[model samples]
Target: MKIFGHRGYALRYPENTLVSFQAAVDAGADGIETDVHLTRDGVLVLTHDEEISRVSSGHGLCKDMTYEELLALDFGSWKDPRFTGERIPTLDQLLDLLEDTSLILNLEVKMGFPYYPGIEEKLLEKIRARNFLSRIIFSSFNHYSVAKIKALEPAALVAPLYMEALYEPYHYAETFGAGAIHPQAGLVEKSIVDACHEKNIAVNLWTVNRTEDALKAQDLGVDAIITDCPLELITALRS
Candidate 1:
């Protein structure tokens, strides 16, 4: 099974920060998963929360603020004082960080509050311009967004995220034109893995931090295991 870093090595560094992403790259994660949100000034930025307060030393909704204002906030200090100066990075910047590497990027489009109008189109435009579509897998909690991505570009790989148990999750994913199913790690069962694999739908379990759980998922024939502790898990798997 391939190992992917969830939110870019979230356990070692602040989630979604460039430092965390770089850490994942250095740690040899096979892929890097990140949350993407559009800024008020129409820029795509990497962050997990719609409200920046949870992850940054700032206040207010991310969509309500421009990229400049968001960039000014200390995104890393909340995690550690040593990382106090780290700032939020744009999607473009993050892509540059992975340049010349073969890491797959799982870009999760966040949806909840303060909707980013035309975000899918805008995001796609940039990806195509950068010739980044091949390495990206578009995922979202909102299945519509995943469908929209397919409608926009049928060739784009999509995986809809779900925390609850879906009846025949892989079949549902197939109906949505998805190439993979991103089930929460806790909800994953070997049966589910078998079902997905039977239909050629890859199973990439998410946010699995425990080594035991990671190995268990791998044993179940998972296509990839997304984890916050990629370094340790990769080491354990290798050992």
Candidate 2:
């Protein structure tokens, strides 16, 4: 299975930062995964939570802050003291940093409490702006977001993330017109993996941290594996 760094090699660096992303690439990840949210000014920024408190020195909702204000917050200190001044990165900055690399990108859109308004459009625009539509795949737990993207651009690769075991994943995949299905690793059974393949939909499992799980997925012929410790996972997979 293709090993993708979840939140840009989160274990080694501040999650979702450009530095972490580059670290994942340096460690030989096939791709990188990250979360995106729209600022009050409509610019797309790389982050994982609706609130900034947990990951950054800033407090309050990310949606409430302007891009400039969000940019001013220290995002790295919470992870480690050595990374004291790291700030949240813009989508453009990330793309620029990865411009010369051939690694694929998996951008996960977080499903906020009420869902961020116009976030779908803003995200699509950013991808188009970078001309990264082909290199990136959009993944989300929100079926509405996937449907909206499919409605606007049928060619876009939209993957719906599922956490619980479902009776008919293929039906749902077909319903969303998705290119793939990304289920939480534990929820994925061999049958589900086979079902997705039967429908020609790729299967990617999220947050896989154990070498045993990675090897299991690889043995099962899963298309991709999402993980936080990309360095370890890649090393283990290689060995």
Candidate 3:
């Protein structure tokens, strides 16, 4: 199973910062996961929360501020003082940084109050321009967003992210035209893994932080596992 970095090693580095992403790659992550939201100026920036308070030095909703305004804030200090001046990075910046890294990127689209219109289409265009369609998987908690992407581009590799357990995950996959289902780690049972596998859909669990949890997911036959400490899991798996 491939190991993905959840929010770019949220534990050890500044979550969603380029430094964190590079750290994940350095730690042997097969892929990196990050969230994206369009700024008031329509630039796509990496961040998990709709508000900048948790991960950035800025205050207020991300969508309400222009990219230039967002850039002025320190996105790295909250995690540690050593990373104090690290600014929030644009999606374009990240793509440029990881161009030759051979790491698959999981870009999760985020939409909340004070929304920007046509974020899906905008994000798709950027990805296409970067020619990262093949290396990236588009996932969203809203199945409708996944459906919309599939409708726009039939070949898009859409994945539905679920927090609650489903009775039959394959059914959810089929309904959304999703090639994968990313569920909360605890919600993923053997049967859920089997159901997705039976339909040729991949099962990817999120936020798996420990060595034993990753191995447990691997033992259950998950296709991929997302973690904050890829090195720890990789070491355990190697042992």
Candidate 4:
């Protein structure tokens, strides 16, 4: 199974920051997963939460702040003194960093709640402009966003992310022509994996950090495991 860094080696570095993403590459991760939000100025920035206070020295919804306003916040200091002064990175910055690498980017689009209008178009436009469309796998908890992505770009690889168990998720995924299913680790089972594989749908589980869980996923024939500590998992799985 392939190993993807969840929010860019998030267990060791600040989540979704450029430094964390670079750390994932150094750790020999096959892919990096990140969350995307649009700033008030229409710039696509990498961050997990709709609220900025959780990850940075800033408050309020990320959609309310301009890119310039967000650039001033210390995104890494909250994680560690060593990471202090690390600023929030724009999607362009991340694309540039991954331009020459072979790492696959699983970009989770943050929508609904405090939604950014026209975010799907904006994200697709950026990726298309950079010619980075082929390297991305778009996923979201909101199935509408996933559908919108597939509708907008028929060639885009999209996946539906869900926390709760759904009846025959592979069928749900097939309805949208999704290339994969990103279910929380707890929701995965060997039967589900086999069923998905029968339909040629890849199953990528999330937050699988424990060694036993990773091994279980491997035995279940998962396509990939998205974990917080890429180095530790890579060592455990490869060793």
For model 2, residues 1-239, the per-residue Cα lDDT tens digits are: 78899999898899998879988999899999999887778788899988889999889887789989988889998888998889999889889977889888988887647468877787787778888888888888888887788788777999998888877787788987998988899777788788889999999999899999999998877999999999898888897
Off by over 4 Å in 2: none
Which one wins on lDDT? 4
Ranking by TM-score: 4, 1, 3, 2
Instruction: Give a tens-digit lDDT track for model 4, residues 106-221.
Output: 99999867887899999999999999999999999988998999999999999999999989999999998898999999897889999999998999999899999999999999
What ranking emerges by lDDT with the best candidate at the front?
4, 1, 3, 2
For residues 1-239, could you state the per-residue lDDT of candidate 3 as single tens digits?
99998988778999999899888889888999999998888899998889889888779888889989998999988888999998898999889878998998998888545566798899889989889988888898877787888888777888989888887888978986888988989888888788788898999899898887888999999988999888888888976
Candidates' lDDT values, in order? 0.90, 0.87, 0.87, 0.94
Compared to the true structure, candidate 3 yields what TM-score? Answer: 0.97
TM-score of every prediction relative to native: 0.97, 0.96, 0.97, 0.98
The lDDT, on a scale of 0 to 1, for candidate 4 is 0.94
Residue clash pairs of candidate 1: none
- Backbone collisions counted per model: 0, 0, 0, 0
Candidate 1 lDDT by residue in tens digits, 1-239: 99999999999899998999999999999999999998889989999988889889898988899999998999998999999989999999988988789999999998757677898999899889988999999999988888888889998999999999899888788887899999898787888888887888889988888888987888888999899999999999987
- Better model by TM-score: candidate 2 vs candidate 4: 4
Instruction: Identify the runs in model 1 with alpha carbons over 4 angstroms from their true place.
Output: none
